[model samples]
Target chain A: MTREEVAARVVGVTAQQFAMKTSDIKESDQFTVDLGADSLKSIELVAAYEEAFGLSVKEEEALKVQDVGGAIDFFFRLLQ
Target chain B: MKPYELQDVPTPNLLEDTFPYSLPPLIKFEGKIKETIDGKEVEFDPNEVRTRDIHITDTTFRDGQQARPPYKREHMVTLFEMMSRLGGPKGVIRQSEFFLYTKNDRDTIDACRALNLKYPEITGWIRANKGDFRLVKEMGLKETGMLTSSSDYHIFHKQKQTRKEAMQQYIEVVEAAFEAGVRPRCHLEDITRADLPGFVFPFVQKLERLSEQVPQHMKVKIRLCDTMGFGLSYPNAAEPRSIPKMIWRLRNECGVSADRLEWHGHNDFHKVHINGASSWIYGLNALNGTLFGFGERTGNPPLEGAVIEYVALKGGLNGVNLPVITEMAEYYERVIGTTLASNYPFVGKDFNTTRAGIHAGGLRKFEQIYNIFDTTALLNRPPRVAITDKSGTDGVALWVNDFLGLQGEERLTVMKVARIQRWVMDQYEKEGRMSSITDQEMEEQVKTCLPEYYQAHRKN
Candidate 1:
């Protein structure tokens, strides 16, 4: 899937998961952004994103995820 | 800072005490009885929109999915069947939890449409939008609860919209749902905090205008939610009112059919059910619930408690077997991978049991009278079961006493149950859970607390 498609799925799923609008999630959306998502929520979303796209975000790579775009890029690059 | 204790952060208003306090009573429901030869169960409530709640509604598939891994459509059907078995004045039709989450959600909606399921009007949750409502049709869902942010917090911080735009968007989105042949249920979030005069009044005036403009079933059923669990004006106080009694006042004063009013709540400090129960008393037609109060944050009032309160306190009907609900809770825990707290009151292992000799002595009469000598005991501290190991201390030379009442002996051959409880708690404390408590973990805590009872009752 293209970056947008992958991001769309992840954002769509995460938005629904947190009961928010997709517009609520920006490419720069931080897990702890105004949504007040804590670490547990962040981890849950990451795992779901991994599962939804069928890829792994290694622990070390996880430290580099700063926003939704970064997370999506990490997954997309892994796919490549 | 530790994580678990972090979730326990005190609420904002944490208002001083106010009302007669105790966990609300359990409800007993004798659902719609039939004159048919076999007495088959039925859903139609012939009564007019009067009484505690005229509407029987289920938000499980819609709300329960928020618990964790939302269910498959097939799973929803089975859950509905079970809820139907439990009984309700309103039949069960909670569209999937995520209003528009997945292809599977769409598939489930389509399956419901193909089956032509009727009973609990198939209402799905949605934001005010054309696409969001459009997905309902893909799932074959004909009814939907269209929610738009009403609270300033949601509009500005969450949705980044002015109240005016959200209202306009609401009308547009709702119209779309209608064009696609879906029933629209309207939910106004943070209604408890939204400015009644400035924000809410004008917005609702438009909806009122819409209700009058639309065909009857085409009209929306509005639900008021205490989203953040900011109970009434003051939640932290000893006698706390539920979130925004002012909302209830507005709901009542605004001339509308009881069908139009519904109440939803979360439990930051445990008053959502009381708020819901109060709404029922005030003539709101429909009340919402999750099977075991599983949802985001502190979660909504345990519908189990609401149903119990109706039957046990108000002499009304709910159509649920309160005893069996614990097992249903267990299922929720396993699926969500969490637990319940020992002190959760209704389903917890310690909710009905007593640990302190003085406390147990007072609680022994509760099953009969429904009142402990001091009601505060039940509130501040959940009924705890104390296990005293008298096997070695009582010095009966141990022929194995009644196994039922041996100085409340609650220890096992190797260790005391109290010690085990402490051990489990130590583990939980180390795990760290801040923000707000979720229902799944609360259930897990109860399971962890039960070992003492099991160990205490070891067979001879």
Candidate 2:
């Protein structure tokens, strides 16, 4: 998957997890602060990303992806 | 203030000197502990416990029975057999005193003796009456504890006898025990509430003098019974209540050797276990206790607690079988129909179960961070997470991995169990559930969420 593809998937997963629109989700939007995801919601987003991408990302590293841009970069590196 | 500077190091100083995780944390003493008694400073070497033959004697059938309904004959026999294993070959739990009044008690003693596992040698408890000597002699028990009430509260109020009359009656029973070749352990009932200098010291001195005439095996053992839980372990805490001073006086002033002196305590003040342990440090060899602290009124010092303290003080298990404590708890629940308090240490249902999110996270990262010791290795109980709203995804992940018997990197991550954690939250949030998610419910959630893993791992 390329950067745009990873970004689009990460955005879609984040939107689905937080009940928001993919258009409303942005690269700079923080999972907790901007998207109103609590600890459990953050974990659920990581789980959603794992399911959507069909890859088992490192839990600690994936959970550390604070913003939408970070999640996109994280999954892109894993896909590469 | 003393001059101080940070001695920073590259690695953490985990202080293995005291907190060696394989064993109960060791009780190390640097120097002698001093106690002021009768305007004199008495020094007791606390380190003596490391080498001393300090041990536990049980009163489960005696004082323990006083608190609750009488255990069935088989229940007593099973508990007695389990106690022998719990103590092991070295006899850390050296003796168990039994009631001699009923035929059922006698049959239970016979049944226990029939199993014939050594250590926790059977003994009898009876009033200070010579007639009870027949029971001790008939049972062929080498030792028996005879009540020799010490406090004026017991003598004047309860027994309706003056101090001299009570002392005479107690002495006659000791004499009868000697004649019958049964070693008399004088249970100095309510010694903590007695006039120690006036009555207790004099009584113990006389008993010691009497012990001089008998053979080594027949010497009178003094059990300093803290009957109402008034004994204090603090330094310079006044007499009649101060455990240290009472023990010091018993060993030094009254001339009772450490081996012949036992500390029996009650939990009326929640100081039972400590007071019993402090007696060992203050120079007594035997701590008289009951299983799980079940005894008269409040309770006795928990024999299991004392067993843990014994390992801590000795810095090893010696011959003690610690996991049998778990077995004994199970036997009590399954057979004897008793359940220990859920929060009770070492042997409770929730003793090692963490419910908090942050604690579960710590447990997931490193078990030692939240667990007291290796409970799985020591007590046959792994540290566990009880799923609740407070138990986050970390808790869910831990519970799932443990249920699947997964280990190391094979264990599923928090992300894998996040769906189950959401269901757990929905119980409290959406459904307004007030109780924790039971293991059965969690298993169903596991089956529903991670069907493949559940099928692969738990299908059997």
Kindly list the per-residue Cα lDDT of model 2 for residues A1-80, writing each as its tens digit: 78998999888888888788999999999988988989888888888888898988788888888999999998888888
lDDT of 1 by residue, B1-460 (tens): 7655445556543221211333343233334322211133222221222343444456766665676676766766555544544544344222223356667766665555455544545567777778775567766655678776678888889888887887888878767766776767778888766776677667666666767767887776677777777645332222123332343344544545666767777777677777676556545666687766876677776666655555544433444444445545565556544577766656654565443434433343232232331233432323333333211111111111213233333212111122233333344467553332232433343346444543655343
State iRMS for model 1: 16.4
Location of the lowest summed lDDT over 10 successive residues in candidate 2 chain B: B16-25
The CA lDDT of each predicted structure is 0.55, 0.91
| B228: Cα error in model 1, Å | 1.3
User: What lDDT score is found at residue B312 in candidate 2?
Assistant: 93
Q: TM-score (0 to 1) for chain A, all models?
A: 0.81, 0.95
DockQ, model 2, C-alpha based: 0.91
True-vs-predicted CA distance for residue B220, candidate 2, Å: 0.5
Docking class of 2: high
Error (Å) of candidate 1 at residue B290 is 1.6
